[model samples]
Target: MAARERLADDPSITFPGFFDDTAVQTDADGGVVELTGALLRAVEVAADDFLGPQDANTLCVDRHESHRYRVVRRQGIIFIRIDEDPRACGLTVPALHSGAQYAIGSDGRILRRLRDGEPDGSLAPTDAGSGIPVPTSEVGRSFEAPDGAVPLPF
Candidate 1:
């Protein structure tokens, strides 16, 4: 795609997989970030469609302005760095593997809890916090596992 045409997608903002053959980089705060293996796989699958063959498969993440978060590609996978202290939401990075599938949605809190389960050391996820609670208005949000999967509306 031409640069001018691409710019029309969203100028002043670059996203992961924006380029087909370039390593994505983000400059943000250093903090602890976590995700389940499932989520990582989903993202990987998603990238395969947008990124070119020469592009390295990875999502580099860093802090964003106003306490918001951003995701990018690096080393053949996608990543998001959670703020130690979140503003709108109390979302801490959930410890997850880099090889499983996950569901990403606007309601990250609900999705994270569902995918990561509770930190209390339990095998099965708890129903209380199992389902992530996202605003119905964000129902149109789409997501994919780090495995370069297709976009699924949540």
Candidate 2:
């Protein structure tokens, strides 16, 4: 039962070859082959089946060297989320969404077009823990011009 739960949430075990663009094909063996519509449908079906309804919560370890992953299944559709860094570009800025929110299928695939449970933008930036503005230190500038230098008259 645990294995079944992992299969639905873990991308690696859930989808063979992670359903790479040119990974699976039929009508040819041991050689490069063109992807066909039938092959694609097969993969989709495999995913949908493996991700069937599961227990309250499923824990799956990512084999792709990705961050820790968790799944929340509802109505047979699982939402895959990762423990991601909240900062972007390593900048000390507040983003508009939470890092661990994504709409995913029970098959360990993300629903690119779907936005499930909008992220919490209320998260404060790490740099500004208390939401207090931090001021940049101002360095004194050299106001003295070059010795014997004169200003040009316009």
Q: Model 1, range 1-154, lDDT digits (tens) per residue?
A: 3211221111212223323455333343774557566555444332322222332333222122213223443443333322212332344452242111122333221122111132322234557755887899879775543564755456
Question: In angstroms, how far off is 23's CA in candidate 1?
Answer: 21
Top model by TM-score, which number?
Answer: 2
Error of 2 at 9 (Å): 20
Write down the worst ten-residue block by lDDT for model 2: 59-68
Q: How do the residues 1-154 of candidate 2 rate in per-residue lDDT, one tens digit apiece?
A: 2322333232222211222333332335677655445333333333333333334453232111222234334554444343323232343442333223334454434432121244334334466456755455534544575575776455
Q: lDDT of candidate 2?
A: 0.36
